[model samples]
Target chain A: MAYTIELFMVSVGVGLISGALINISIGYKFHNKGGLIGGLIVGLLMAIL
Target chain B: MIEVFGLNLLGLIGLILFFGVLIASLRGWIPQDILPVQSALMLTAFILIILAFILGKPIGLKDIQMNIYLHPITALIAGFLVAGALEAAGAFKAAINILEKLSKTTLGLPGTVVILVNIPTIFAMPCGRILAAALIPAAILFGYILAREHKQPALASIVVFGFIVNAAASCGPSPLGGIGMVGEGMAGGLGVAGVQLGSFVNAQQIAIMMITAVTMLSMSLVFKITPDELLIASEEKAEEKREKKEGVSREGYISFFFFFIGIAIVFITQPPIPIQTILIFFVVVIMLVAKISVKDLIGGVILHPIMAMISGFIIAGALVAIGSFDVMIQILNVLAQTPLGYIGVAVLIANIPTILPMPCGRIIAMALMPGILLFGLRMTEIGLPEIATPILLTAFIVNAAASCGPSPLGGIGGIGEGNLGTAIGSSGRPQQVGIMIGTGIAAVIISFFGFI
Candidate 1:
């Protein structure tokens, strides 16, 4: 259970970071803020699943 | 005869295409902005993959599948995220404030300048970009102050570009996702018994300090950059206002405290916790204390270095798949047989990254690490001293780490140039000379005191 929780936490952190990075790298480059929302959604979903 | 000069036709073509496109694009024989070097490298990898399929080489598949090294990539991402968190918390602003106060002490401005200029190497970060982005404003402010006080405008360029060179090279000694770790990891994998993973870090840091000093000296003596001539009034005013308004907040000191404490803990304890996990734990703590948002962290991430590293890995995978490294090794070995001998050839090979500098040192470091390793070991086999292996690796890694400083195409020096409003390649010559001397210093240090 402890290991599982640790994994989940790290996964969430990774998800958050990856989402932010993609948002800025691709979204900001193209002047689209929507990418942040979409990325966060996908990131959270990936983390949860 | 399917072979040309000891290499198969396929290997020869792969080698030619790999170096040809990379050098041509980087050197501006082909325009880089239109077809960026990373894009060109990815295309080269794709072409090699296609050729491997046509040639029916099964070995290529194994290499491609297994050799796309990801340890450094994962580490880099974690490190960058940590850097972003630290940036969002204004830890760097606090640092600049501390240095400013130090300048008023018995140390005075010149002593503070040396310390401030060497901060990146002093506290080596995973990506030099982290410190470079955070502290460049400080460099500029001090640089302008020095220039105005001395009535020599070139001092502005000197201090700024000197700090830029230091930031660029400091990554070699960084314990995080530093370029030096690439070599250390390679050495560990080679089962060179008793080789500690970070034995080269100290030597690299010592050499980098000399490199930064040499770079400043070179710029002062040889390069005549008139930043006063290039300064934009609006930008200058905005920068001055920004510097003046930033008072070190409580959160800034708090975040800075946690950041370094975390690194110190990790270094001393060698904890069982995953470094990523530990870093994340601190990030969360810092976020709460510093009142920074995810949005702020997002703004801190610069994708250029990350993307450049990945592109290099891809090309390395493709070349490995095509057996190009074997052909490269054979060529180096043959060259070692000449009047140049193993020592001469080894020195040349170690310094090649500086000779043909890329925009990101990791690109060359990753792509050519295997070939460098094999060639270094071969030199030892041919009666070069056993100690020469680590020395060669350290010299090569430092050279690769610092090469980006002089690179014309989107290298770290571009950041300093843009801020100074100078031409893109103006600092290239001085920076290169510094890197060359630094590489020599690294080799000498390792030869004298190295244990791993």
Candidate 2:
């Protein structure tokens, strides 16, 4: 349980840092575009599954 | 403790404002530095209570003690510590390095890198968007590195992997991720019956993942596009940053090792609040260890998450006010009593959420039991008032799946656009959006029959 807690936190932190970098580098337009595609695919998969 | 129709209304209102801002910003109408949903919601709730105190709306300044704000604050602190600590530990770096290394090998290079990196995440997390939030930077960095090497196909492959596998898998679960989260919620608290995630590792989840992966991988090869090489010469760049290495205590390695340990521990342990909390905890610790400030640490929580919450509020309000959720549920209830209505029931159930709105896409996963029941009952003509459970379950599936798709009304599309790259404003947007919709729709249909 402790281990899982640790991993989830780290993954989240890494995610945040990475997110910051993305914001600085490519700008939000690209980020939003990528997010939209990911969202659609994830949603579709979630629906039928 | 204050709740509104299964969600905290305080949070819901805040979430709506955030989502509205995100939509406005993405449309190029607003500035980028608006208050994040977390801050916005918390602030809104606080301000509202303050106003309420003046107006005597039940919550006074004294009515709100430190404990009142404790829940979200605890979540934030805990979330930050978990994320930072593990990132400082180094799991993230090693994993990225290993994946990159595998892609460099003669036999394994490029072709298998995405598949190798993506599988575990698909079954492990509840939200693909959340996974995307985690993986996109890694992919982009990989792409950046590859761009430096003039390895366009490699970079493309990495980016595609981030978008497809890590992002797409958040929708459905067999024994992994957020779908699993809602699956448990429905099976346990609601006590209605449907496919038990553990018992049902069907073809749906696998098939969608595979197809998307194949599509992205193939697109890379076909386009022969490498973002084609670096604009900056590699040698001159090396000299610029090499000097700064002495001052910092190398938090990256700590982040790399500890973070991997964190993920490994989570996979092995599978604790409460999901393993993601652990991942974020390590990230926070790494930042602290590395000397990043509380403000910077808070900044890492992402503005989009706040916006996503805001979007959730708008959606929940609109759905309830306009009777969208109810209307859809009624439609499903009508279809659940036929003999072979599973196909229609399945398709409809999967599609509605695409139309509805939400903060977290995983909310869609709760639909499995109801959708399945609707299909089964629709076929058998079970129209008793007691048959409502099956009816609700059907809607849940569609809502869950659609919420994650390319909906303009703030579904997973909103989350994706909020956090990842899309074809939003550029010429590529049409193609990107097309791919998103085409693939998503196909995946939805396939999942109906368990086509993994």
Candidate 3:
């Protein structure tokens, strides 16, 4: 049971790191001018819902 | 599953929207001009109504007889009419003249505008997609004007960034912002309430604050939009982006500020009220302040009392048609109870549909929430909900971090950049891309770890 749990955690962290990187790379375009506004709009949506 | 012209009700409806967007986009090619997205949106609602009635819906407000999709249909119509009329009326321009004069003074224009005016937008654009539209076009125009002058982009970008992430990262249960919704859905999937479980029992806000600071700093890295630049461009293009927004909707101001107070009370006050109620209250205030007549307001409310209610009803109908929400819920419960940590479980589940390029986190409520509730039983089994609160909050925050970006599908990243370089027409600033990208990435990384 302990071994299974550790493996699961490892899988999750790895997957998330990849996913996060992809999302951020793609999201970087929003860095300019109202990018803050744009990104935050999306961020706020995520926070609320 | 009976076929109507080659598909069932759901499939047929889906195809109509699909083809509608395609048709809308295609028109842009010939005219080299986009279809008034208004036309496309209106047609989408029209077709949904027509389909709902054709599939054996009856007429009248007798509840069961009336088509569920009609609400969205009328809501879209009413919103467009009022907004269009307001623009034609030059309601904002009337307010603009006063600011133009004040901007000519030593204080300059955009400098004054960003502090008092645009900061409020962070509070205003909560619904994300539709509500943000009102400000997105305006923001793009402002960014272009800033680029035209030798002004650094950081100052304006930071203010906009604050609103963006705040709305996304906003805590509590308020529907006045999308961040609240994201929090709710995430908490709900874990068999918890957002304001109560994720918020009340955690240190998530600390992380958010930290991340927010970093994000702000990074947002300023590009455009070299330092305090120095504002003083330099006190006139010209800077003033063009900087005109102070006159407060026309006094009622909107009162209601919005109250809306913020209500969110604050959610944490510290007694007898918690549903944030949904708070949302309704503010929206009603907005309706009145926008000068939408009482009669029109009533009509629109009758049409759509709930935000996205039409989609809700349609999904409800789809559940019945496809079999049962109960069955999906049971499957979800089974999956959620497998001792997988909530973060991993949610990310895995959300990304599964990524192959089809579907949205994250929202659609699974009917499918995965039951499993989450079942898993909550495990918490009592081992006394973990309180113990794991911090971990759970972090996971939930991570989930809220999505955007349309460099991708063509209107991702968050792309929307942010749309105003920076290519988004500004003609004399656009391609030179600013690397700086902006660097700052945005820094913000995202900080957010990934939890707070500013």
True contacts kept of 3: 0.00
Question: Where in model 2 is the C-alpha error above 4 Å?
Answer: A1-49, B1-81, B86-94, B104-107, B115-165, B168-180, B194-208, B211-257, B269-297, B310-324, B332-342, B352-452
lDDT per residue (tens digit) for residues B144-219 in model 1? 7776677777877877887888888877877767888778888878865445656677667656766776777667
| Candidate 2 residue lDDT tens string, B374-398 | 3444434554333333333423432
Worst-scoring 10-residue span by lDDT in model 3 chain B: B425-434
TM-score (0 to 1) of chain B, per candidate?
A: 0.95, 0.53, 0.45
Docking class of 1: incorrect
Model 3 per-residue lDDT tens digits across residues B9-114? 4444544453345344333431313443323433454454455567564222233222243422332344333333333233333334433444455424342233
Candidate 3 CAPRI grade: incorrect
Error of 2 at B337 (Å): 10
For the predicted complex of model 3, DockQ is 0.04
Chain A TM-score of each candidate structure, as shown: 0.51, 0.48, 0.43
